[model samples]
Target: MPNKHPYTTLISAANLLPNAQLENWVIIDCRHDLSAPEAGRAAYDAGHIPGARFAHLDHDLSGTKQAAAGGFKGRHPLPEQDALIATLRHLGINDDTQVVAYDAHGGMYAARLWWLLRSIGHASIAVLDGGLAAWEALGQTLSTEAPTSAEGNICAKPTLVASVDADDVLKNLTNPQRTLVDARAPDRFRGENETIDPVGGHIPGAKNRFFKDNLQADGRFKPGHQLHEEFSNIISASQTAVMQCGSGVTACHNLLALEIAGLHGAALYPGSWSEWCADAGRPVATGA
Candidate 1:
């Protein structure tokens, strides 16, 4: 079970104190903004949850430039397997460590870490429920000081569980074994909104389930039983499905939702529509 999926948890401010049981747990702060790339690092420098390491979107997780071919594309792309392996090792992650990733608002970008670790075939990872927001709401103490990097190194175990490229998506356009789920807002999915990506609407047969819908007014995700009901209407209990969104960032939101819903086996389309439009040959659909 090196890459087996783990349940997401919310650690109380009081309980976050390090102990032998929690020592193997790796916590990462994944705050980011597309408009202001430095914001996350600056925020980390200012103050963050104790015992957290910063995972910058542009620097730590994704590639800086697009690949000539078979590499990353618009927004964010799947990083090289070997390079990602090295990243986990430096983070002091190992197959047994319980990895918890979190962002300021919710598990948005943090979910990407959840997806990536699982994609590489490591399932011992999860997103922090409610993210840093919930933790701070509990009046937790934060730190401006960075935690010391552990002396031990992690052994890389690449499992390559779930993914779908533009070509694979194209081939699956009519395939029943898979279903495309867009994590964008309803208006955006319907082409009523197009502020983010250049294109509007969604893939021809895709379904829309705004990741926000899964969250309660308090910002935490709904209970798993409720999630199962919501997803069962759009996705079969048996299928793991595929998730996407603007530039592939928020799509991880959906993947996170499914995990909460007890729906695993889903794949992430990291490049998503931004990467899709990068190739003119790919078809674009508009309107609701």
Candidate 2:
């Protein structure tokens, strides 16, 4: 039976338990360390939610990096449509598959998968709120054994999510059509940290809204109304929002928070600051 209440944005571990074993459901472990790329797979190999398949951020989720005439595409570009479709099929994700993506990092990585699915027009996907900790807190068992399934026949559809490129963002800098929201930490946004990306500061007009703020102390997302109020303060009712971050990964966390807050039509800047700062011609801003 199809899940009567299919999860679109976020799913609790308790709600997921009942349908976990269902054939139409696919659980993905998206645990990833930006610094140590191999750590996510190692952690998955050590133990994960039973029957969960691993999706590496670099291998499965991101696309090949390109060297353009001006600058390189950000670290993690969106995967090719066909390549992404192949990955979904390999993961046994059908059109109706209820994908529940989880990670140890407060759904930071899982939200990437969630947004990717939505970008390909798959609406039945969700991030596991509170992630693996939530499941273990409920006394769920982990498994080292990997599970396989028949290849799926899911196809691509129109993207349900919106996105913008570096050009669009540059235009926005002068024309000011949209409000840019930076999802990186305040220190990073303020040009105080340069360990990850070569650039230290953020786009000139971008506002800092660290993705962690969307989560509570327990690592779960705050209530929709609360998220709405917080985000509204950053973005005005008349202004369209554009979300960005280092290499464009965590921006999805903000996008997911926007969805939870019922604020729709926000666009993702996939290249983000990593790409923006790649070309020195582009302007940069520092400080709060």
Q: What Cα-based lDDT does every candidate model obtain?
A: 0.74, 0.92
For candidate 2, write residues 1-288 as lDDT tens digits. Answer: 455778999999999898899899999999999999999999999999998999999999998878435447899988888999999999999988999999999999999999999998889999999999999999999999999899988888899988999999999888998999999999999999679888799899889999999999999999999999999999995138999999889999999999999998999999888889988999999998
Model 1's alpha-carbon lDDT is 0.74
In the predicted model 2, the residue pairs found to clash are: none
> Which runs of model 1 end up more than 4 angstroms from their true locations?
1-22, 70-72, 158-160, 174-176, 237-240
lDDT of 1 at 211: 81
Quote the lDDT for 226 in model 1: 93
Estimated TM-score per prediction? 0.88, 0.97
Worst 10 residues of 2 by lDDT: 63-72
Q: What CA RMSD would you report for each candidate?
A: 3.0, 1.4
What residue runs in model 2 are displaced by over 4 Å at the alpha carbon?
Answer: 1-4, 67-71
lDDT for 203 (candidate 2): 94
- The TM-score between candidate 2 and the true structure equals 0.97
